[model samples]
Target: MPVPCIILASPRLRKTRWPRLVVVALFFVTNCMWAKGPAPATRIPLDPLGFQPPLAQFMLAGSSMLTVDYVDSDHLLLTYSTKKLLKRLSDCPPADQDRVVDGVLLELPSGKVLARTSWRTHDHGQYLWNLGRGRFMLRIRNTLTTFAPMVNLAKGDAFAQRPFIRTERRIGGVLLSPDADLMILETMDPRPSDQVLGDQPREEDKPVQINFFRLISLNGADIDVHASGALRSRVTGRIPANSAGYIAILDDGRQHWSFDFRSYGGKIKELAAFDSTCRPSPMLVSRSEFIAFGCHLSHTPQILGAFNLRGEEMWEQTMTENYVSPSFSYAPGSGRFAMSRVLTRSSLVDSDSFSPDMFGGQEITVYQTDSGRQLLHVDAAPIARAGQNFSLSPDGLSLAVVRSDALEVYRLPELTKEERKAVQMAEASAPQIDGDPSMVLSSGNGDSTGSPERSDPSTPPAGTREQPAPAAADASSSSASVAGSTPTPPAPVADAGPKAEAQTSSTSASQQAPAEQKPSDIQGDATPDQPRRPPTLYAPGEKHGNDPAHRDDPR
Candidate 1:
């Protein structure tokens, strides 16, 4: 607010006007003192729920961040950096040629390992929870280590047998979901080809063959096999690629298959046949979505995929490519789905973005499930690209993105005029300070306007005397010529130390006050009974957006 201009003149003694003049003078003094109540310090506005603190970056042993799993709410089972593990097991060369060292299971914070399982090198791990035997499988050297669930370290291993049961024959990917009394294990094993006839190798290899999917009850009961008996391999394989197939068990014990081509005559059902000879990556089945990896035929190859929840091939979208691979996370309540892509590259800019020869970049795509419309796409800025991940507010109106080693937040576009007004009002009501009104009434150097009444310097009133203004109010005030919109800069000071400190303190206080205020406080007042509610959480492994109907432009 602009400081109120004050004109302090000698108290006139006209009989009728005396009382009115005294009242006006008193009111001005009180208002001026209140207005000058110590200028507030400067502050920085920050989002409450929409801010992400940086996680300590530890370029772990392998080329990727250790895949983390929630053991419960308080603890996480992480395949963290294993240089130490590798150092200790240097003598134990990988039996299967996988470089990933069996990581020591360490309790977070304490960093105490309850047990150590044999290691292998792979990209991910899956936790298998059975009522009778709760275990997790870590895929490194193509070995499956089934260990007791470790929620608390102090409890020790629930039943320690090398901390896990090691499996052989190379299970590239595994999904364990039980239905009724049955527990199904679907592992992707690439098909082998035997005929190397003429120059038709590429065409021969292009034929889509189904991978082996095993259905065994955790309780070891009945076995139901489908298609042409069990799985067989053709011998013309060149590259070491895993088969692409996904298995999902609905609540009613109805098994859904996306890539089980045998049952569907080796044709495209929910899953599509390869666009090229390269075998597709293993399918990922999250709660309500199914995502199958797609391939690109370029130098710096790109990873693509399709998503579907209803297991219908009619609606599927070919997602934008990324450097590494795409992973899906959904908040059903907010009706927003996030496709997180990890960029293993050190550079932020896409190779192709600069040079046509270089054709790879990293990005995270967030889409609105209801409309299947992309809400935002954030490039993985190089500075903090490795560990930085995006987190969203519960309402989905704001997104918290961490990149470039700096935190950035963006408010979602408003859906209604009322919401826009509220946002504007909040910004306008932000705390602000103005210069002291008393400055306008003072003499050339801030001294009292009434110079005719000068008191002795030694016997000044209880408080210090004010300084006079710069010059006579008339000449300076008229020539000042204040601009209409642009603000007047503060008058320069001698030291600038105390003034700067005061400003800083005021800003800090204002910012801190808002920060301390909880989101609930603001939420209660503006709560609206929105008609359509979004989903709160999504199953991690289910494929989403695989249905062609969900795609903006079906391909």
Candidate 2:
């Protein structure tokens, strides 16, 4: 930031003192503007947060940038909607438009609005979250209501109380645990027909669609389930493909489950048994990495990778477009993680289907969740869907974007003692894969695809910006089925706009047998958390309302 050069010098001969006028004005101001050549790329400095001109024009006219999180890093937790709930949020029904909602807490760099409030919400979108510092948690279905702002903001402290009763199971997700203590509630029953129908069924045959899992253990608003289970899928399966916390990858992605729900007493404990499988057109887990992508047919090729819950890989790649969505935001204790690349723009609607036009706009990259380095690279404009504009600051060093003109905030870049000694000398000359680098796959972009019994493994390497090349459109005219065989129906986007990314919507990344080459009576297994894949807030690929270990709707 240096530009003040004003050196005319004609009257100089009439005045040059012995100083030659401060050494020829410091050599034309160091080659005009403080000569610092070979340093041209720079754009991670934001810091907007203004909001006051009529509350920033009614917060960009309602639904206020749909939740710009972070309850600490100096407060920030906006959510707006009023103007008759933004004109009856699509055909009236919060009891006809006024169901109330408005929150503030702001504060950053003295853009002060410190506290403001209002609430009633029963699913309009983004149910709050951020349980560190001043506290925050709000969910609406499967009820969980917490808010503290240092304790008491018109009262709310019932973080969960639903002793199993939704008819035949109906809550599908409620996950938290990056240290919000622990949770993994799930309840699947209504999501069948991706059809596999083989390998042993017959309990009088067809009623299998169970997936109950419960493992709780929170505190503060108390919640203790400890263990609960039900996975009964006697054939007709389509991916235990991905799960989080007590880990699970089930049959299609081959198998990797790994649970330890607190030293086994109530039960849910199995670990180690990975390294194998490519059937990933979706597998995103968290609570110790797992990012799979593979599935774009023309005989497979998409590939992608990040692995290590023993499913190995570490970093592989390939995705020459097919609706590029790939998202991520995470900021737990700020070791950082951004990763975007949305671009859905697929348009078509019917003739076999294609969808993805959530206004289109992406291409991000924050990284350094370890050696993935690349501290901050930007590009966020297709407002409204795809990580809901942008947010990451639960101590990950600020970054709340809703840019068009205001509500910015970006301060996340640091680690230059020669870039942390070139990332600890490239994490000590790479090549460790699991246990070598792994805090869950980090040798970031030094690229590595060996080990795990090579055999090609679809090699592609080089990451940090997950799989950028985005600029989508041309899914080759939609409709396809062959991965788990029969699951083609993706094409609805006239409105399912907000709340996206912990993805799952494949063209099929087929080809299995990897969790240590499957089958062996495979018996139950799981990791620790699930229920948070909820913030792609619009589009990427998956539709799990989550992945904070909630995988897609952990609630």
How many residue pairs clash in each candidate at the backbone level?
59, 41
TM-scores, all candidates, are 0.34, 0.25
lDDT against the true structure, per candidate, is 0.29, 0.36
Give one digit per residue, the lDDT tens place, for model 2 in 1-555.
121223455545446554776766776786664333122121222233333222322221112235666666766666554433333345332222134556666667655665666666643334565545555656544344455563443354212222222223323344444444433333323323233323323322322222222223344432322222222221212121211222222222322322111111111222222223322333333344435454433333255555443334455655453333344566634345666654443421121222334324555666654345555555554333325457677656656665544566767655546645533443343222122101111211111122233221111233311221111001221111112221212111111112112211221111110111111111111222421110110111222333111111100
lDDT of 1 at 194: 37
Give the TM-score comparing model 1 with the true structure, all chains together. 0.34
Q: Which stretches of candidate 2 lie over 4 Å from their true place?
A: 1-66, 69-78, 81-123, 126-335, 338-368, 371-390, 393-413, 416-490, 493-543, 546-555
- lDDT: worst 10-residue window of model 1: 518-527
Off by over 4 Å in 1: 1-65, 85-135, 140-142, 148-154, 158-168, 171-229, 234-324, 328-338, 342-361, 366-370, 373-555
Model 2 clashes, total count: 41
Report the alpha-carbon TM-score of model 2 versus the true structure.
0.25
lDDT of 1 by residue, 1-555 (tens): 222233465544565455876867786797777544222111112122122222232221112333333232222233333333333454443222223433344343343445554444533222222221223443344333334455323456533322221222323223232111112222222223332223233321221111222222232211221111111111111111112222211111111122321111111123332242222333332223334443345323233444433333322354343333344433433445466554443323332222222223345566554234556656543322222234433444444443443334444443345534433443352222122111111111111222234222212233322211111111112011111222212111112122346455443332223112211100001113321111101111222121111111111
